[model samples]
Target: MWPAVGLTRSLYLKELYVARSRWRSGVGTVLMRTLFEVAAKHECSRVEWTTDANNPGAQRFYADLAFQQLPSKLFFRADATAIEHGLG
Candidate 1:
C-alpha cells in the first residue's frame, strides 16, 4: 500500500482481487474515484504510476482514469549477481 502524505501529492490504487462476484459490485470504479478525490484534496497537480508493459488491462484502467504515457524509458542495472558468491 502507498502511504498518503498529508496536504502533498500521492497516488495509488486500492488493490482488487480477480473474483467474479467482486467485479460485479463495481468496487474498482469506486476505489479509483476515491483515490482521485484524495489526491485532488491535497492539491496534487498530477498522479502517476506504472504498469507492466504487457498488462493491457492495467493500461486500459489507467487510461480510463485520464493518465497519459510519459515520454521516458526506465532502465535497470545491477553490479552484483549473487551476494553469497561475491560475484557481480
Candidate 2:
C-alpha cells in the first residue's frame, strides 16, 4: 500500500483475502490485527480499503471489525486507445 497524503493520511490496505476453507476461523481477524499493528508501528493514523459494492460478505466482514463505510465514487479510465494519442 502507498503512503498516501490528504484526508485520512494513513496506510492503505489495497487487498486482503482468506481462503474459503479458512472463513470464520479468525484468520482474517488475526491478519487485520497484525496489519493494524504494522500501521501503528509506521505511525499511520488508520487503514483504508475498498470492496465491490455487490460484495455483502466483505462489507459484513469489515463492519464486524468496526470499519466504517464511506460514501465515495470510484472512477476508472480505460483508455488504451487514448494512450496512443497521449491522452491517457
Candidate 3:
C-alpha cells in the first residue's frame, strides 16, 4: 500500500508470500531486495508491514531484513451488515 503523507510518499508492504515449495530458495530475499530498490526509486522514507504475532518465521524474516518491529494491535469491527456491504 502506497500512501501520501503530507509531502512524503510511503510504502507499505501489506503482504509477501512465497509458495511453500520455494521457501529457503532465496526467492524471498531477492523479492525483498527488489522491493527496497523500488522503494528507493520512489523515494519512500519508510516501508511498513505487519505479520501475525504467532508467525515467528515471518518475524525473523523481517528482522533479518532490518525492519524494526513496533508494538501494535490489529483491530476489526465488522458486523454482519458491514460484511454484506463489503466494508468488513
* TM-score, per-candidate, Cα-based: 0.53, 0.75, 0.73
Model 1: lowest-lDDT 10 consecutive positions: 1-10
TM-score of 1: 0.53
lDDT (10s digit) by residue, model 1, range 4-81: 445455664435444656753567678777767877887675565566779777677667767776769473445565
User: In terms of TM-score, which candidate is stronger, 2 or 3?
Assistant: 2
Clash pairs of candidate 1?
none
Q: Which predicted model would earn the best TM-score?
A: 2
Alpha-carbon runs more than 4 Å astray in model 1? 1-21, 73-88
Q: Which stretches of candidate 2 lie over 4 Å from their true place?
A: 1-9, 73-88
| Model 2: lDDT of residue 26 | 97
* Residue pairs with backbone atoms closer than 3 Å in model 3 (clashes): none
For model 3, residues 61-84, the per-residue Cα lDDT tens digits are 888878778767464568898788
Error of 2 at 33 (Å): 0.3
lDDT of each: 0.63, 0.82, 0.82
> What TM-score number comes out for model 2?
0.75
